[model samples]
Target: MVEITNMCRTTGCAIGDIKLYCAGFTSANLINPLIFRHLPTPNHDYCIVNNGNPLSAGAVLSFHYDNTFMYRDFSVSTVTCIS
Candidate 1:
């Protein structure tokens, strides 16, 4: 199977526009779509993701995870094969 790398590339994205992105894993044939909204914020310190009340410019973006689904899996293991 072919491996996919460097996805969700944005092109000509203007400000104040909502964008959708899809992510996939190399070990499985699954794709997860995520939504991103660009709002007027001071910095990347605090921001809201998923579906929530849109905050105005200069307003603090609280971390509200009521309407979002974040999937992640990471682990480390050691294996040895006898020759």
Candidate 2:
């Protein structure tokens, strides 16, 4: 298990990004999210399970999720960025 933290960048802004890799494997699973406004402040919950194998060193992973919780037009969630 690994935890990553970073600041917001205009060039590549990923509020929440997640990536999973299998140890001793060459391929990886990528999970990129669409950030939505008016969703919920600290309202989203994400969990990943690795059934094949545990992750090892030098494994690459990437993911992005929305953090905004409110919007003026709609009460539903909306994605601000996707990459």
Give me the candidate number with maximum lDDT: 2
Cα error of candidate 2 at position 77, Å: 28
Compose the digit string of candidate 2's lDDT tens values, residues 27-82. Answer: 13333323111112253222222222222333333333333432122121221333
lDDT of 1 by residue, 1-83 (tens): 21212222343321222212223212222322222232234532221232332323333322222213442421112112211
Model 2 whole-model lDDT (C-alpha atoms) = 0.28
**CA lDDT, every prediction?**
0.25, 0.28
User: For each candidate, what TM-score against the reference?
Assistant: 0.18, 0.22
**lDDT of model 1 at residue 65?**
26
Model 1 residue 58 lDDT score: 33
Q: Alpha-carbon error at 80 in model 2, in Å?
A: 35
Candidate of highest TM-score:
2
